[model samples]
Target: MVLPLSKDVSGKGVNVDQGSLNIKEVIDLLNGDAWVRLVASGAEGTWSLRHLHAVIGSQPPAWPDHDWIYGDIALLRAKLSIDRLKDALVAEDCRRFSVGSIEVEVPEVGPQVGWRRRPSFEQHDRERLQKPTWDLRVSAAQTSQHQLNRSGYLVGRSCPSFPDLQYAFRAFFEGDFSLNGGMSLPSELMVIRVINDEGWIGPIHVTPTHIDVQVDGRDLLGASLELYSTDQRTTTDLNSPNTVTFELPGGLPDTNVWLWLKKDGRWLDYRALYRPWATPDQLEAAGVKIDLPVDPLSTIEALVSGGEGPQVEFKRSLPETKSKDRNPYKTIAAFATMEGGWIVFGVDRDELTVVGLEVDDINGERDRLANLIRARVNPTPPFEATPYVIDGKQIMVLRVDSGVSPPYGIAVDPDAKDRPEYFVRRGASTYPAWPADLREAVMSRQPPAGFPNGMGGLGGAFPG
Candidate 1:
């Protein structure tokens, strides 16, 4: 009873039926030319690769132990064919048992539809010119016969075996080789250890529909695979031909897309690859361009053409270096507290014109702006200071982020005179965020408010 007790009825299987195999079947296979198809790693040993001569074969298995396991006929009515079994074994195993034997070829199965860009998106000069063909060749079919071993694909994302993957989990890793009741290892049978995470034995393979693993040729200690779902046109990392990569779609509104990989029964895989800057087109359409990347004068040139809105704001010349008003900390706090935006210096807010600033010391001026935020703002939000000379006028562009911590304000000095703390963006103007606005900012995860749509109060006025 204890022999089968460890078998989890709830375990997930990829194309795995987990059907019954009787002791008679095992004995018959032992006498005949049958061997269990276990996915093998010469170094890491075998993972959850178990097969009953029903499918493709694999070899070496470099095992320390493997005892036959099967469900009794009285308890489980699993079917097995002795005659068809031998042919399948010979055909399956020794498909080049070593990684050195691997010949580069696309698997019989092709990449899935989502893996490749649709024909509609790529067939024209305009479309083709606008969007380069996203190559789907990076992801490859599982070089290891993990599937034939009866371990499933994806599901919990066993990782893909990259082309150069050669190392295995040392004996120092975890888990022991499995053996059933009173079973002796036959000299003809090879023993192997099962490699798995949190009881899920992953014989993972790389495919476009799946996440790529083994980056730059190293196995992460229980690495994670995440998939971001966006509009199909979204940008992905740059890579060479045959380098495996997946895509985060574009055009659709930004969303939080997640693909969780569980290792050791705990989920932990966090990494960020892209910076969320509005595309040039996105900025142009919205009539606002905040240089988050802190680009040079050419990129900053986009701001002169458009009027300010919720995402964009403006400020007049500073009162003094490190002075309370030098950096617009209160408004910066509001922008951080609400939706993130930009505040441009060397421009007249009242006239909406690029009136130049008289500059003697640029570094001193930059330090002043930096220090003001360091002093006045409560939980200062992240912002970039990009200096540009536009048409002979010196301009300072500061791009800000929606704060991770909400309720940013003038916590530095309640006694500071004329300091407008706890403010928010209301269209083209900045004003005090009211009790209601603060409540809403906390509730909405600090998304930028519209003056009418995001913030509150009249057209250009900030609500108390």
Candidate 2:
């Protein structure tokens, strides 16, 4: 039994130096007016003498007696004794909340009966789901057991602080088991909340044949949800009120994408639904082979063998062709604005031969191309201009990856700061992207997760 030291001892306090008191002596002192303080501080809260004695001494009749017999109480250190007291109190509270009382009636005494453990309060009540009481009870029992199996005699004084107990309690109430110092809680006990705008969004699952996204919200029922990238869009109306399954269309360019909700004839703000779980590892685990970047020589060979197509363009020289339609900058913009392609300088498209450049300084030529791209292409895309030696011929191969931020454009006038013109590649030729294509391009790169929608309209303007 444990009790707080009353400041008003009235000279009745026992000399603690005369230690090793028995259980009866401790109970007598606590039941009387003068009690020994088990806790060092009063801020730990007060416990009544009767509550302490009953928890340590009382048991139901025919209760198949356990290790915690009366003699075991005599050997308990102050900290373990206090922990037991706390556990009993929390368990009592749980029992009361679950079944309206801590008292449980059992069968009459008989021989050869199975030893029954006390019923956990959850067995009594399941629907109400009083999580706070359940969490506190479990944490208290765990703390008591942890203190009992220690290494040293410091068990008498060692106890977790009030704040530590509170943190454990909160950890149990939430879904975070990591905060509980290696204690594993059951998965069903975890309560997690996913924060999102319209509703909860599950992980974006990507496989070779399909990409699936699961979204759920009561407000989204019968509403249209749109998932789009540079050149593709997939829309679906919610049929299930709880979770709507979205099977995104195949052939999406490798870009970070967004999900949009159409409401009141206008598209609401878009947000990225990709989490850390949406990784290349996940795709590979599902039997999707992640293609690495091909070697430049290998790509050049493939382009030469295949000739000019939608994703490959050949240029004979550096300063751009005399015809505006054949300009190298237009090809760069087209590759960036559409699915990306390569611009091979020093390659004659008509003859399908690598004629090679005559420049002495290859690095300087690369820098010139880089500077021209910066001046000509608005919102510069990721590209590489490298000098490759193929069969003793030097050629400049500029490879542009598919743009994450799309609608990349070429300047209408390099000397002026006016809006640039957008273009796309089709079958071996580059041309101005139509109004619809430009809209899709602009929609491909939405404002990132939390920023407000800054693009005023979807007509022809890009997000500033």
Most lDDT-accurate candidate: 2
lDDT of each: 0.39, 0.44
Please give, for residues 265-288, the per-residue lDDT of candidate 2 as tens digits. Answer: 433223343334556544333222
Across 162-266, the per-residue lDDT of candidate 1 in tens digits comes to 111111111101122222212211212112111111211111122224334222211224433444455432222222112234432332224433333323343
Candidate 1 residue spans exceeding 4 A from truth = 1-295, 321-327, 350-353, 411-420, 446-464
User: Model 1, residue 33: displacement in angstroms?
Assistant: 16
Candidate 2 stretches greater than 4 Å from native: 1-295, 320-326, 442-464
Backbone-clash count (model 1): 22
Candidate 1 local Cα displacement, residue 412, angstroms: 11
